[model samples]
Target: MRSGASRLDLLAARDARHALLVRHAGAGHPALVAVALNVPGEEKSPPGAEPLFRWALDQVIAALPGAWPLHVGDDALGPFALLASRAEAGGAKTACVAVEASHPAARLVDLDVYAPGGTVVDRAALGLPPRRCLLCEAAAGECIRLGRHPLDAVVARARALLADAPA
Candidate 1:
């Protein structure tokens, strides 16, 4: 299958897993994390994405006190997976947002903390800065809004950044 189709399939599977987790957890919150890439093309699982994802996950585990390893999906989709854990004090959404804000690769990681009722925790409510663009220091939303850079340029910049990241 083409990479785009494969990505959709992976996403669908991830959603199913999330639903299952919700059903099983009853009232527990869900922490969902995935790798985010700048460009969309044939290369979905870029060179450094898996390592970066793993590293980010490790950081999340360390930050969330009393975290438990529940389900770890395959790295077929560049380390896309979910961690079902309950923190000691703050809710799961708080813990997930904390990890997103503090991770070194915050630009390349998409971490969402979901409430037990399935609502996502608002990053804006937490007062986190807008995500920066992969190619430029500008806000990512602004760059995409203005089409400030070509896809190739952004992809190249992201690749270079990943290259420098320790595997």
Candidate 2:
């Protein structure tokens, strides 16, 4: 079994492979959607991670009409690799942000949308607000950029959020 830290590395490699697959498929703009977690230790794939990821993917699929799935990989790394053919990357990203915002486990789970080139699609480009901190109302980016909170605190809050999620 891969350690949680190594799982992240594996996820990066998988992402590169998916990008190549997207290019080979001749899709104008493919979207790679996955879960984002605020894990503190070497336990990236927590208990509810996969379930939350699947729920988020379902929402994205519903929002993006006519999106054809090109690839689907459910791994132990808690990264749900979903590549879909979409007309506009921005639209797909917007839908993903909406799902993240509406989900009960929104704080603990993140639905990230990546463009064909392997770069993450920005939520701001789609007129979405910056992601809020898992523990507070501050922007998540700011907290991360400044290392404002202890890792343990963030992780605990994430666990609590996951615990409160609907079964």
TM-score of each: 0.72, 0.75
Write out the backbone clash pairs for model 2: none
Query: Where does candidate 1 clash, by residue pair?
Result: none
lDDT of prediction 2: 0.64
The stretch of ten residues in a row with the least summed lDDT in candidate 1 is 32-41
Query: In candidate 1, residue 74 scores what lDDT?
Result: 48
Give the per-residue lDDT of model 1 (tens digit) for 26-87.
55544433223233344656777778767767777777755655565543244555655665
How many steric overlaps are in each model, in order?
Answer: 0, 0
Q: Which regions of candidate 1 fall more than 4 Å away from where they truly are?
A: 1-27, 30-40, 75-77, 88-104
**Residue 120 error, candidate 1, Å:** 0.6
Q: What is candidate 2's lDDT per residue for 33-101, written digit by digit as tens? A: 554444444566677666666666566678887665555554434455455646466777777677677
